[model samples]
Target: MPIPAMTEQSDPLCLSEVTAAALLFDAPWRRFGVVGDSLSAGVGDPTPGYTNKGWADRVANVLQRVCPDVQYLNTSEFGVTTARTVAHQLDRMAEFGPDLLHLPCGPNDILRRKPDFDEIEKTMRRMYDLAARTRALLTTFTLGRAYVVPTFPDWDERIRAMNAITRRLGAEYEAVVVDMWNHPVNDRDNLLSEDRIHFSTSGQAVMATEVVRQLVYMLSSRTSE
Candidate 1:
């Protein structure tokens, strides 16, 4: 049986989705790198079967299908901003020397009070440039809907604005941007974890499937290059 491409428009994921993703996880990850924060840590999502497979983990599972030799080092922490991620990413690059990297951040920054957007941009540029120096390929993920409290006014707008800078940079630097904004899964009942900040087990699987779909496109485009 073929695993359907899951899309949730306020609909919860079914058992079949999880089964399909596990099959996809059979892919290899002998190469790759991951740079992100808590969300990237898979905090809001549950592990597959036994352990929780955060977005990065799920992304790795997907890439393995295409790049059997792919390997990744997830440096994303539970609570990290762009500035914090930038501070440590270069070090990871120096240590791991991976060919692929994933970046997910900014929700926490925006959720905080008086976060220095200027500093965030400065750090972000450094992170971007660092990828080039390390000869590493960078892929970034953006937030769809924040479940955290005191939701920022125009949350979507702010996320898009930040992503705009990322998008422009992606074009200039030739990076991949996976936009999960407006994804139906973000709003599904029990789609996210109890805290409402992360995705539940089913939610993780749903997100993982989407990321894999994008990764397929990304890998296809890269190989043609």
Candidate 2:
């Protein structure tokens, strides 16, 4: 079957698809926006109308249940690397502003022979600017174990370094970071698609547990302060 094109009004997150179940938490947060690459784009899983694995869409689902007032924007583009991530996010921030921005990106950057770390940093800085302009709380998603292998020389180090950069960007911008470098969801092969890079529909559901757990906690922490 052919894949249908996603729409602007369409939601890219699918916490429901993430089957971990435990990561889902109840909390109150206003509407938000999500930005990133293919993972955030919900590229792999097939769910007829919507691929139920994008963490952004999943968080939106959880928010709808926990805080109906919560809304989110998904600005994900398939095949978008770190360079593209910053550009796309900055552009989106100009239009559909959100209270929060959930970003999931960087894998593609590692695969490239010439990783543009400097360019990546510049883009992240720009992302921070958009976050400021939108007054949108910023947050991010890290790769699960499947995405990284520390034993490797070039790939692992570069990925970890990029992750460090991501964390730094989050902290500098005063944003929350959702780190999933090693999670149990990958145990189930059914959750991972053939590509291995992308999560299986079932696997996406498991990832949702992490996304919601962290997001709701962030909202709670904000409220406490």
Candidate 3:
């Protein structure tokens, strides 16, 4: 099926709506830490009508509104792979002692000419193992279908493999997985930035909204339980 034309008015969710959704969660998280690649860094190009802030920052801002004392530490860097993230970012995150943590899903791991899924899984498991020791509410997002690498003809397959690994690890660690594989936002024509890789600010807004909603669901489920 073809995606419909997208316009400024066609954005699925606005920043105000993201804030509103976040306000619904009476979350207990006062410390948030994020680590991994550019995705974890919330890298994106600015859209005409959307805020340039990445999803992580937007989420952090919302959390700050809910808990004024909330401390956010994002040790993510652009162009870093999963293994490098484990090496460089994990210690800082552990030291920060976050009550809420966001881990990477290894988008860069599969960007290589011949990605070693076995090594990727091993490294990811190690990363998660260390992260779980922090006893934080872990969170991550699967890659959106809109994210692509024209150079890699098998990009879609690589993404599927990567997302599967993410889902599996996320489940093992009891992490909140904001599955974005086939999200409606992926249908937008303006989803990607000029790099044709990273999401645009519009996509970032939608991502932040979804993350808030998922966190609310987790909180709500705990309350009911």
All-Cα superposition RMSD per candidate? 5.4, 7.5, 3.2
TM-scores of the candidates are: 0.75, 0.75, 0.93
Order of candidates by TM-score, top first?
3, 1, 2
CA lDDT of each candidate?
Answer: 0.64, 0.64, 0.88
Model 1 lDDT tens row, 7-41: 43323443233443454454333567777677677
Question: How many Å off is the CA of 32 in candidate 1?
Answer: 1.7
Candidate 3 — which residues are off by over 4 angstroms? 1-10, 14-22
Candidate 3 lDDT (Cα, 0 to 1): 0.88
For lDDT, candidate 1 versus 3, the one ahead is: 3
User: Model 2, residue 219: what's the lDDT?
Assistant: 62
Collision count of model 1: 16
RMSD of 1: 5.4
Q: Please give, for residues 1-225, the per-residue lDDT of candidate 2 as tens digits.
A: 986543212433333423323343444347667677888766565533434455556667766665566767777777777667776566765577677677654776667666778887777676677667777777776766676444445776786777888888887878777776666655544555666668765555556556666666776676799
Native-vs-model 1 lDDT? 0.64
Candidates ranked, most accurate by lDDT first: 3, 2, 1
